[model samples]
Target chain A: MDPKVVNDWRLRGQRYRLEGELCDHCGEAIFPPRDICPKCHEPAKTPQTLSGRGEVYTFSTIYSAPEGFEAYTPYTVALVKLEEGPIVTAQLTDVPPAEVQIGMPVEMVTRRLRTHGEEGTIVYGYKFRPASFWHASTQA
Target chain B: MSSQHLMQPERAVGIIGYGSYIPMYRLSSTEVARVWSGGGRGPIKEKAVAGLDEDTVTIAMEAARNAVARAEIQADALRAIWVGSESPPYAVKPASTLVAEALGATPYLLAADFEFACKAGSEALQAALGLVGSRMGDYAMAIGADTAQGRPGDDLEYTASSGGSAFVVGPADLAVATLLGSLSYATDTPDFWRRAYQHYPRHGGRFTGEPAYFHHTQSAASRLMEELGMDPDDFEFAIFHQPNVKFPSRAARRLGFTAEQIDTGLLSNLIGNTYAGASLTGLSAVLDVAKPGDRILLVSFGSGAGSDAFVWEVTERITSRQDKAPRVTDYIRRRTEIDYALYVRYRGKLKT
Candidate 1:
């Protein structure tokens, strides 16, 4: 299914996603937000933004689907283990169903999900891809 | 008389009011089993189906309205509204709040939900009594309703009935029935569960019988007898959560309760398993014929966990206000019948 029109509403003004963690005791960057500061019990934690990039932990080919995505009936939906620790489930976009493999690099891409048939708001969410970051160390 | 010392002058929070809602519709099991599959000695002959707009929320609200009317208390008097059902309309939103609104309960009234599979409603009642016994409020409302649906060809399709019942829990003088004793136990084993969301809860065929239903029910009931100093012959009416009409009867035999001992439970064969409301609805039926000082022993089982055993003493308040709540048999007889096609339509099993 084409995500361009569907994701248009959710990503209307922002094409980028803020996907990292903001800390409590001392402002810090932590991937997959740490349960504790490993220091204090302040319990005050704010979200931090990071580049949405990860490796595929597992994937599945959805041979059966409900209506709308008749064209993408056999699409792949997978869990990409974010470097920040959160394992996010998303549609494996920009890739063929046959090519998916564990440990493949993926990055966040905003896309639309279902349709209301007319001018209804479309659902939006993250998708992954093979890494091509300008910096090599970004692999971490 | 010895137990009277244990009984305090505490206000008995009873159903100042009670109301029930069974969709004005019915479907014979024979029709459902015949239409879904050629012939399977299954959910064999009937069930209740709700209209598309009726889900758990509406059914619960309609019953709440009837109960509030019987109690004659404004919706505003409700200090807490708790709904127990496996089929909450939404995964995120609270159905209790919606019920509170329609019934005019105070907005801040504690609104919550509980799901212990089939036992959820009775469990809610136990908790509500504890809350009321502590003077949490003069009363609280607990409702159980379900339109439990099974997969197209699944056996559960037949007995998953739709209905709701509300009990107002409060103290002694205003109490219709007082909770005398309770016994319960929990064990985590899957005799039934619905992993695929597409179907109603599934059980391991009759695995629910030996392991889940009988074991838990016997455990709880025995505990009740021991705790309340009551014997099987001492009760006038006993209600058990009915998975099917045969279950309660079989369990009664195992517990040494005679066929006539559990005669009140004979009602489920006609209306099917109302899930959360199953046993309570049965209790409602028993109350229809019970007299003051009559003792009722009840037990409820919810798979993935436990059973609750409770004994209630029907007081003069129950009979004086018997006319207040609709008679159980009357409500059972006052249903609207539907054919297999409309049954599917009401069940949302048909395509738009």
Candidate 2:
């Protein structure tokens, strides 16, 4: 892995925390944020951190993982639509791949992404877990 | 108070809010037993497994978020962040910094990692108490988390599990639980240890008994009780370091605490031993249902042969924050059982 790739990830640490941009003009939420809003085609000027809650828009289970992630073969990857309005793709966690569903409520959680080696750089990122798992039986 | 006394803060400080995270995946002992043997045999029900993307850093981050929510305080209010984990993602780098960054607590704060086998979390809490009580920080976050590992086919494998708990510590006046006092007892007795560069720890088997877990836990609890002039009967609930169901249950009984006193906090039976997270998670469960003014006792044992014990009183403010984060029971109840093959994968036991 390129040291630059890991360094570049450091710049996007805010993404791991759900920090994004809100389009002031068009009232849109943009993630993996950009200086210009894709919707309004203007500067998204306003900064916003998402509520970190969303629903699974779509998902797939990867039986054959990419390099460095083969140990987690048959894992769920989901395209989550945030409550704010951006669709972010992340790995689904906590629950098994078979349990992931469209529209399933989820919440962002920080986790290790991949490690270069025992003595290598380890990448960390965000993943989603079912929000219902937390509140399911505890709600009054 | 005597001038010569145990280490404790003069100004009261305690958990203003707390939270825990247990990975959803579980592997039953029976499944593990089936692999080593032809049939069934093991100590506990099941143990949690961190997914491929999860580690102590991730576990602490989740727990910290929930704790901040329950604390109803901005993450920036935390002046220091201490994470206790034997299985920190990096051996040299501090997991605390990453955790603080992820939680939006950065730029100005103290941060570090602690390692003392299982009681590392309690060790962090002790530091938090000192920081907040001395007014150095209005609030501090102490976390105990781990993705504990055991050698294949080893007894520890049945119980070594993954999970974490976080506590937001602040002045007792605003705390959900008030820490009356706490004490620690430690010695160089090595009942368990993993050398540098070692993958799994080596234990002395039965030697981990009588001398390590039992002696340290019993001594800490007993000494705290004696110092505070309190007894087992005075407390409503008691939590002990649970390396296994048998150890805690027996320790509680030997300490004169009834089964009812320890049952609410007894979780290793379900989630297995969470190492640094074990006792704190147990305490979190007890705090979940404890009524205002209820007294609770917590004693955690780490296998360097040491224990940290504390007596806390539930405050009226607890009710307000109880619902802010998911209860420990919620995590315990929400689990998906997996087979051994998947467990091996989830634990990354496969040779690449």
Candidate 3:
């Protein structure tokens, strides 16, 4: 069995659906969910699913990618502020780096993050795309 | 074997909602020809290309979410989720499981992956109808998605593309389009196939026509119409599995359907062949503009060789749900063109 599989499995909720902890006492949203809340030091045991709709708080374009991501050089990564009040750092897709703007509305989409190797598991996670991409004209 | 009559579910079943997903990037056939053949156009104008981070799994998930949104039903209410794809991301893993998980329809859901070349999506659609009609499940989702590949410089490269559609089948009363009947025709013709451990598929060229696509598509459509006591004139729209622009048009004309009948549903000329997604995406496009009481005829052909023919009638629910999610034509219009180098990189045609 691959060790990476266990780690990926543990993070499926956050990776697959943007599931995070909602603080019951403080009524605040927490992402990459820690069991305890940072705001009030309360137990944030309740699970909440984010709307996956957000605006780009900030971004950077990586012309030189790190190991394992050389194929995706010139990709843009962004800090997205979710509608539910949580900030997430994720890769942006479908739009060119030059087109990326701060405060741009984006939506979450499931996409391949990386693969371990030729025979290893292919890891999939959430990425953001321009919301306008989904609102094309009905007339073809 | 040919059925004496069209198959009906134990109870009335229909599509509660439907949705389609086409990737944002496109690769022009002209670019493909420029690289290899020294500049001449290929069959279609351009083809949708999935990004490096996109695959059958992601495409299926997006389509499923749109379907659930249009159905106006809770994802947990869906009892079954089936995905049909020729180019699933993993050879060993099931794409359906991941889709089910992403939709929050896990544990209690009956999920599985299916393959039958291009007809695979309709295969799942038939099973969904049966599941809902039998009263075993109130709602079931059938998805046909693919990130199809062709060997570098092969004729198939010009047309192979990525896209998919999903349908939620439920009781007729809640349906946007009701399924009237269905029929299937199959044979061991081996017109196209990929052997084990092979990355790309091979075809029998001209043999894929006449004996495989035409024979099975015509046989199934003719037989279904015959058994249902209907004619091409009875349908407002028609959809056929589109490998390219020519085949489906020729098949439609030969089957007595007027060009106008298939005009709205003919999308291959714009987006290329999406394999298992071919016919289902066409259906989604027709449903986008179909009026209530309109009838639709759909026939899908797979290369291993088989065809699934279905008859559908739109209902008032279609009008309200058509705008709940992005329409098929919307995806068609949202495009970003890339040169051959970027296309090859995105599709992983060139190994690292």
Top-scoring candidate (TM-score): 3
Which candidate model has the greater DockQ, 2 or 3? 2
Interface RMSD per candidate: 27.5, 1.6, 1.5
Name the candidate that leads on DockQ: 2
lDDT per residue, candidate 2, B1-352, as tens digits? 5633456687888899899999878889998899887768689988988876888988899889989999999898899999998999787989998888788888689999998999999999998999998989899999999999999899999999999999999988889999989999899998999999999999999999999999999998998888888989999999999988999999999999999999999999899999999999999899889899999999999988799999999999998889888888888888888888878877878785
Write model 2 residue lDDT over A22-110, tens digit each, in one string: 88888888887787999879888676778889999999999988888876667899899998888998988777677788999999888
Per residue, candidate 1 scores C-alpha lDDT tens digits across B6-91 of 32225455556666666547788777667777745464255666643456776677677667756767777888899999887666
Q: Residue B277 CA error for candidate 3 (Å)? A: 0.6
Residue pairs with backbone overlap in model 3: none
The true-versus-predicted C-alpha distance at residue B129 of model 1, in Å, is: 0.3
Name the weakest run of 10 consecutive residues (lDDT summed) in model 1 chain A: A131-140
lDDT of 1 by residue, A1-140 (tens): 55655655334222224334556676555544454554354453575555577899999989887776444456788988877666767777645689899998887644344445545433333456555421232223
Q: Candidate 3's residue-wise lDDT over B1-352, tens digit each?
A: 6447588998999999899999988999999999889999999999999988899999999999999999999888999999999999889989998998888888798999988999999999999999999999999999999999999999999999999999999999999999999998888999999998899999999999999999999999999999999999999999999999899999999999999999899898889999999999999999999999999999999888899999999999899998888988788888999999988888987856
**TM-score: model 1, chain A:** 0.65
Q: Higher-DockQ candidate among 1 and 3?
A: 3
| Cα RMSD over interface residues, candidate 2 | 1.6
Best of the two (1, 2) by TM-score: 2
TM values, all candidates: 0.68, 0.95, 0.97
- Please give the distance, in angstroms, between residue B106's alpha carbon in candidate 2 and its true position after superposition: 0.8
